[model samples]
Target: MTSVLPRTKVSDVLFSCCQLLDISVKWTIQYDSPPKYPHYDPGTSRQLLCDQCPPGSYVKQHCTATSPTQCAPCPDQYYAEEWNSNDECQYCSAVCKELQYVKQECTSTQNRVCECVEGRYLELEFCLKHTECPPGFGVAQPGTPESDAVCKKCPEGFFSNETSSKAACLKHTNCSALGFKIALKGNAVRDNVCQENTDTTPQKCGIDVTLCEEALFRFAVPTQLTPNWLNILADSLPGTKVSTENIERIKQRHSSQEQTFQLLKLWKQQNKEQDMVKKIIQDIDLCENSVLKHIGHPNLTFEHLNTLMASLPGKKVGKEDIERTMKLCQPTEQVLKLLNLWRIKNGDQDTIKGLMYGLKHLKTYHFPKRTIQSLKKVIKFLHRFTMYRLYQKLFLEMIGNQVKSVKVRCV
Candidate 1:
């Protein structure tokens, strides 16, 4: 019979050989087949399935139990540019032109936004330079990063001669208040030029002694004098004074009884002559009024007057107080009437007739009883020596409203 061999497992074969080689033995089992998963050295081998994507590429798919990580290059205008675990590339930030700046910064998922820089404006996708308002035009609205500037033609008596971004139209120059003659009148694009006055040196009656003596007699004699009227006349004359020496001189001139009677006769005649002179004066005042009216009284608008009333340099009329008064008196004919009254009461009218000249220009149809009473107070203010300097100051402010911008003239 053939020798029968007992079936033995592979593990037992090693143990059986070990037992034959030694009297007593201990065994440690080891496998020679490869491991279930592949192995690699981190320092020398290729990247494994779990490794991150390298620079300039992003992961297209995640690593799975059976597959390695899948990757793709960054598309145009997008970038990874570094080793990352991100699922997508970053979008490029905005590259603005010289006239623009970044309005919103870029993010990994969002694109950058841009805007026009200061002194420049935007137009569609690109930024364009702003155009300044030219001569004869004024700024209607200022420019911004998202919108272009708006301009309008200057109104009558307003002017502009240079390019500017947001400048308002300048007013024409006033020659009368500056004690200068108008060398050249202004228009919508140019300012008036002034020249020195070549008229009489003595501001009162052109250096005539007779007129000076007449003015003294009209203003000083206690029997003929009304204090309010006399004071206003003194202020208007520019150089005449109320003094004891002048009174003595007048007294000496009329020392004789015959001369006194002759002085009385002359006074009476002059009074009649003054009435006749008033008519001529009224016509002259009308001519002056017409000059301003024809020019649309460019400085007399509500806006111009409001600015002047609120920005004068000194304490003649309180600018803040007047502005408050203006607000209180708005939405009625009283507003325009008050403005005209302010003009009249603060003006140095040479005669009472001249003081009343502003009345015709006022609209009295809707005036309240309070307005009429207020007008009386205005008339009272007109006839005071204390208000003389104030009147002159207000007059200068009036001229300023009608005058060109100081910046343009200085330039």
Candidate 2:
């Protein structure tokens, strides 16, 4: 310090002195400055990186150097599924409609989910009732919350007797395995009807003769004695031959009812098996149109006939009958005819009672309650009208007066 030394010589002297003191010194040489933050700062015109908000939460304030980001959870009926810097959460928008219910409730991090109620499925953003498989068809697949039911035709050896949305086709009952004989064979729409083996003689195994006579009197007519009908009868009885000429001669000689009775009797005698009753019924069923046209009612319509047909026991109707009804162009005439055939086959029971039972059966599965109720009203009106006429006749008889006709108006 006393003598003024050169700058280099003074630096060397200071270094030597630091080494002699036994203290360590380090030097950090920076080549370039650190990179700036990507985010922008408005107040200072500088770049900064702020912390992000987490899921189910929204940022209330951005982070600064001194404090972290401020975040808040989504409120009720609001959701935030991802990390965001938004100030508010999204509102839950899903709303369940008729026949629908909430499958999953709305949460802070998720939206609500909807599904159809029981017996319904979702379609076109709406809920609809599940489809029911009609007779002769079976449920191939069950319905779900998002899809409709699937149906398939019943295969051979299987049967579906009623309309259903969930039941599958069932296997036909094996009468042989159950130690019973098959009274009626099973088809696609009906199960096997089993009966105990009681008869030993095949010739005597037949339905009641009185029943057969009654059925022939009610159902058979002279018009049914055509060449085609005679041929069908001949075909049904392989052992017997039906002569068209003989039938024509018989028809010409006797009255209509007597002709029918004699023709049936001849067919019964020729058939040694004597299953003439069943055979007669089967042949008459082939001429359904003729039978139906012969019997008519002014008050009944095709719709009423259709309901009654639909409600008949599945075994009572054949596949051909169903197919024929479906293809009819003149529904009014055909339906009236069909009702008469139905009456004959059902032993000529009370039409009103049969209609009521049919309506009740259909109301459970197919028709609406209001429609069934309306039909019931019309049936009741018919019943009351008939009863009124009978009572009026009885009153005239009791008073020794001539029966007078009275007009009734139904509204």
Candidate 3:
């Protein structure tokens, strides 16, 4: 450039040379010879300017004309650890578990390696589904990495029912307090345990029931058996010398019960919510059990059921309990006779109403297909004592009067 007014001294020139980066102490201006400036050959030396790294990465080296980006990418197993500039790559952090991960920042290259979790093989880079056993069974011997244990049957009393992803099987249903009799020792069902004891109580296997003995149906009348057994001597209610109106009342009661059952069945099919369905079921249960108790001719007598129903607490005597007890009565052959007797003796409204209510309890006993014929006989015999008269008379009361005033059957 230019010289200052007092021409620089050696010390001043030395200081000035320090300001010019290219100027070195070795360069000098001559006093006698003509002044010349030191210069580098154009082909031999070159100047360089550096561009900073784009966002997200730091530079490792300053770029020179000789190199393109000036800064190369950080080494694997390391990353640019700082802003602005970086001379060396930093090693990856030690957060990874054994066999679990690689340097997301490779120890030597750009990114880290990922590994599988411990004790598990890597599939799709993750722990996938687990092997499981079939239902009502469990893995036997042991489970393994290469091989799963074979399925096995559960023992009586205790059962390992389900095979799950877990190392062990799940426990299943037990029989404690069930009062069940083990039949063939219930086995496991699909992943579920079959209850050990299934029977609530033992029932006689089977019995052949022919028509009542001729003596019993014919001459076994009074002077032969006790008061309760009197009806056992006959099959038809009409022949039993019972009241006609009372007999008819029972038929009407049965019809009403059937109607209610059909309504409840429709309600069930509609698929109401759980709590509602449960309430409906309870009602249906009462009606069903009641019919069985009233109609069943257990030992040709319902004395047991009557006694049971009577003994039940007044508050606890839901219709269900009453009906179930009635089922113990055994047969309609006997029920029809009692019904006939009541109708003949008590033609009064209350008595007729009671018989009608009781008739609702008549449910056919479940027996062989042949028993259906016998049931038909009982039904037909009872049918002859039509309740239309009683129904007409009573029709004024419930059909004829208020519904609530209807007399309770057993009462």
Q: Which candidate has the top score in lDDT?
A: 2
Ranking by lDDT: 2, 1, 3
| TM-scores of the models, in the order given | 0.27, 0.37, 0.24
Candidate numbers, best TM-score first, in rank order: 2, 1, 3
For all candidates, the clash counts are 0, 1, 44
Q: Which residue runs does candidate 3 get wrong by more than 4 Å?
A: 1-59, 62-120, 123-167, 177-285, 291-411
**Alpha-carbon lDDT, every model:** 0.44, 0.54, 0.35
Give the range where candidate 3 is weakest over 10 consecutive residues by summed lDDT: 206-215
Clashing pairs in 1: none
Instruction: List the candidate 1 regions with Cα displacement exceeding 4 Å.
Output: 1-92, 107-111, 200-411
- Pick out the ten consecutive residues of candidate 2 with the lowest summed lDDT: 22-31
Comparing 1 with 2 on TM-score, the higher-scoring candidate is: 2
* Residue 293 accuracy (lDDT) in model 2: 34
Q: In candidate 2, residue 181 scores what lDDT?
A: 71
- Give one digit per residue, the lDDT tens place, for model 2 in 1-411: 598889999997676445322211111122132212245667677666775455455666766656656666666688876656677888987587888888888876678888899999989988888899999999999999888999999999888878989988877755554334788998888877755444531212222222223333423332334434433333443445546644654444454444544455555544535453454445434333332333322333445445557785432544455446545424334433344345445542434456566776886555545445644654554445554444334323332322122221211
TM-score of 3: 0.24
lDDT of 3 by residue, 253-320 (tens): 33333222222222233333445445434543443344344445455324443432233222223344
lDDT of 1 by residue, 1-411 (tens): 897556676556655344323311211122232112232434545534354555445667655555655555555566554555678888786497767788876542245667888877877676776668999998888888888788889889878877888776776655554445677888878867654454622221111112112222222223332324323322332222333332333343332222322233233223323453344334424433332232222223344344433322222334454555545433332233333334323432222233244333333333233433443444453444543443334323322432212111000
